[model samples]
Every structure is written in C-alpha cells, then in structure tokens.
Target: MIEHTVKAFDADIGQLRGLISQMGGLAEDAIAQAMLALQRVDRDHADRVRADDKAIDAIEAEVERLAVRIIALRAPMANDLREVVAALKIAGVVERIGDYAKNIAKRVPLIESEQRIEPVSTLPAMARMASEMVRDALDAFAARDADAAVRVCESDSALDDFYDSIFRTLVTYMVENPKTISQVAHLLFVAKNLERIGDHATNVAEMVYFAATGTQMAERERSARSL
Candidate 1:
C-alpha cells in the first residue's frame, strides 16, 4: 500500500508538471505573436493575442485547483511540497506574463505613426529576449535545475538594459519630433510591458530555485537606471 501511494503521488506530480509545460508554451506564443502584431501593425493578430490570454488564465485556475488537491490528498512534505507550491506561484506569474503580452497587443491600434520610428525597430528584439527568458525559466522549473534558474536571473539584466536603451531612444525621438509624441508614448508602454515580462520571468526562476534547492537565491546587483 505504501508503494502504491508513492507511485500515485509521483503520477500526480508528473501531471502537474505537464500542465505547467502546456501553460508555458501558450504564454511564450502569446509574447511572440503580440510582438509580431506590433511589428506588422496588424489589428487582427493583436486581437487574437488579447483573446488568447483567457486560455492562459484558465490554465492558471486549473493549476491552482490541482495544487490544492495535491496538498490535501498527498500531504506532500519537503521537496515535494516545495515543488507543488512553486507550481502554484509560477502559474500566477506566467498568467501575468500573458497579461503583459495582451497589454502590448492592446496598444497596437493606438499607435498611428506612418513613418518608421527608430525605437519601434528595436522592440521586437527586446520582446524576443523577454520571451526566451520566460521559456528558460519554465524549463528550469520543469527540470528542477537551479543553475538554469540562475541563468534566467542573469538574463534579466540584459532585458533591463534593452529597456533602458529603448526608453532613451524614444525620449530623444519624441523631443526631436514633437508631432509623434502620442504614438511614441504607446511604444514606451509596450517597452515597459516587455521589461515587466522579464521581471516576471525572473520571479519564476527564483521560485524554481527555491523549489529545487529549498533555499532562496541571493540577490544580484543591478545597474541603477534613472528612468
């Protein structure tokens, strides 16, 4: 009976991991597609990205239910309990990441600039880096890889750098072309959303590290930004 119970608990954990993986894939796709919509100025694509956020939210609710059930039934302790709790928190974080992508999508129609702005060209690369961090953080969680989680944390700094550069460029552009301030302001929000996504990814990585090692990751120094 003890052996059977152990197997059942293992199966439950496996199922939980599977759900997280599925949710992560959707979140990653949302970021990529939202950026594509921004780059192409496609309202249809942007609308689809916004609509897809519901799917991520649904999965998060499901994860919460499953996690609660596991705690009630399995009475998981130590590492197992940590893993389950981390999944719950990570689900919420990933859902927020999806929301950030949706926020970016919502801004597509607001930007009406016909001329290609310099800052607009740089946003996609920043979005890609943010998306990659999300992917890696999820991978770390799935593998229970502390080193991979640390790498994800390290990548956050680069994303911050990208945001800083984009912020500076947008401010300069707005100063030079006073007529484009409104449109450029929308791009600034989009950049901020991507930066927040990176921060969310780092949050997930920290959770994963704690779940894997049962110890909190040490804080790393970040460059000070005036903005």
Candidate 2:
C-alpha cells in the first residue's frame, strides 16, 4: 500500500509539471509575438498577442488548481512540497509575464502613429533578451536544474544593462528634439516592461533553485536582485 501511494504521489507531481510546461509555452509564444508586433508596429499582430494572453491566463488558473489538488491529496513533504509550491508561484509569475506582453501589444498603435518614427532599436533587443530568459528559466524549472537556474539569475544583469543603454539614448533623443518627447517616453515604458519580464524570470529561477535543492539559492541569487 505504501508503494502504491508513492507511485500515486509521483503521478500527481508529473501532472503538475506538465501543466506548468504547457503554460510556459503559451507565455513564451506571447512574449515573442508581442515583441515582433512592437518591432513592426503591427496592430493586427498586437491584437492577436492580446487575445492570446487570455489563453495563458486560463492555463495559469489550471496550473494553480492542479498544484493545490496535489498538495491536498499527496501531502507532499520537504522537497516535494517545495516543488508544488514553486509550481504555483511560477504560474503566477508567468501569468504576470503574459500581462506584460499584453501591455506591450497595447502600445502598438501609439508607436504606429509616429509620422517619422525613430526606430525603436533598443526595445526589440531588450525584448529578445527578456524573452530568452523567460524561456530558459522555464526550461530550468521543468528540468529542476539548480545550475541552470543560477545561470538564469546571472543573466539578468545583461538585460538591465540593455535597459540602461536604451534609457540613456531615449533621454538624449528627448533632450535634443523636444518635439519627439512623447513618443520617446512611450518607448521608455515599453523598455521598462521588458525589464520587469527579465526580473520575473529571475524570480522563477530562484524558485527553481530552492525547489530542486531544498535550500535557498543564497547570496548568489541576491547578486542580480536589484536588476
């Protein structure tokens, strides 16, 4: 009977993992498509991204439901309990990431209205970096790879640096040509959204580390916290 219970517990854990992975895929696609829409100033594409966020939101709800059910039924202990909680937490973070992508897509028409657009050069690069981190962080979580999680934490600094660089450039553009300040400011918000996505990905990595090792990721996790 004990062996049967252990097997059932493992199956529940697998279900939790599968749900998170499916949600991760939706979030990943949303980020990628939203950035593409922003880069091209395509409102149609942006609208699709906005619509897709609802699907991701639905998946998050399911992840939470499965995670909660597992906790009640399996009575998971120690590392197992950590893994279940991490799934819940990561689902929330991924849902917020989808929100950011939706926000970015909503900014599309504003960017499209510019008569003489300055290429939102830095925004795409930042989005790409953030999107990659999101993907890799989810992969680490699925694999329960503490080392990969630490690497994701380490990688956030680069995303921050990209944000800084773009911010400086936009400030200079606004100062030099006061007339474009409005558009430039909007671009800054987009950059900020991308930066926050990177932060959330780092949070996932931290959770992954803790779930896998049954210990805090320690000072190393804090190294990129401010970023």
Candidate 3:
C-alpha cells in the first residue's frame, strides 16, 4: 500500500511538470509571434499572440489545482513539497511572461504608424535573446538540472545587455526626431516587456534550482562571487 501511494504521488508530480512544459511552450510561442508582429507590422499576428496568452493563463490555473491537490492528498514532505510549490510559482511566472508578450503585441499598432529606422534591428534581436532564455529556463526546469538552471541565470546578464543597447538606441532616436517620439515610446515599452520576460525566466530558473537542490541559487552564487 505504501509503495503504491508513493507511485501515485510521483505521478502527480510528473503531471505537474508536464503542465509546466506545455505552459512554457505556449509562452515561447507568444514571444515569437509578438516579435514577428513587431518586425513585420502585422496586426493579425499580434492579435493572435494576444489571444493565445489565455491558454497559458488556463494552464497556470490547472497547475495551481494540481499543486493544491498534491499537497492535500500526498502530504508531500520536504523535496516533494518543494517541487509542488515550485510548479505553482513557476506557473505564475510563466503566465506573467505571457502577459508581457501580449503587452508587446498591443503596441504593434503604434509601431505601424512610425517611419522605418535602421536600428529597428535591435528590438528583434533583444526578443530573440529573451525567447532563448525562456526556452532554456523551462528546459532546465523540466530536467531538474541545477547546473542548467545556473546557466539560465547567467544568461540573464546578456539579455540585460541587449535591453540596455536597445534602450540607448531608442532614446537617441527619440531625441533626434521629436516627431517619432510617440512611436519610440511604444517601442520602448515593447523593449521593456521583453526585458521583463527575461526576468521572469530567470525567476523560474531560481525556482527550479531550489526545487532540484533545496538551495537558493542566490546564496550559492554569492559565495562564488568575484571581487
């Protein structure tokens, strides 16, 4: 009876992980579609990305349900509890990332009215970096690999670098061409959204590290910090 109960508990954790993976995929799709809409000025694509965020939101609700059920039924101890909580927290973070993508898409119309600028290249490149961080962060969570999670944390700095460059470029343009200020402001918001997505991905990575190792990554990295 005990063995069977343990197996069932394992199954519940597996289901939770599976749901997170699905949510991660949907979040990644939203980012891609939002960026594509930005790059090409496609309203249809932006609308689709905005609509698709609902799916991720729904999956987040399911994750919360499973985590609560497992806690009440399994009475999971220590590591098991960590995983259930991690799934719940990660789901929330993923949903927020999806929201950021929707916000990015929402700005597409304003971008459409603006004249083309050469530095528009920077925004898409920033989106690509943010998307990759989201993908790898979720992959690390699925694998429960603390090393992979640490890598994701490291990648956040690079994404920030990308965001900084885009910010500087956009501000320079806004200063030089007062007429484009409205559109530049929209693009700035879009860049902020992508930067925020990367942040959420990093948050997920930290949760994954704790779920897998029972250690907060921040403490570990601080111990290894260079002067």
TM-score of each: 0.95, 0.93, 0.94
| lDDT of every predicted structure (CA atoms) | 0.93, 0.87, 0.89
TM-score of 1: 0.95
Off by over 4 Å in 2: 114-116, 220-227
Which candidate do you rate higher for TM-score, 1 or 3? 1
Q: Per-residue lDDT of 143-210 in model 3, one digit per residue for the tens?
A: 88999999988998898888898899999999999988888899889889989999898889999999
lDDT of 1 at 37: 92
- Please list all clashing residue pairs in model 2, or write none if there are none: none
Q: What is candidate 3's CA lDDT for residue 83?
A: 82
Winner of 1 and 2 under lDDT: 1
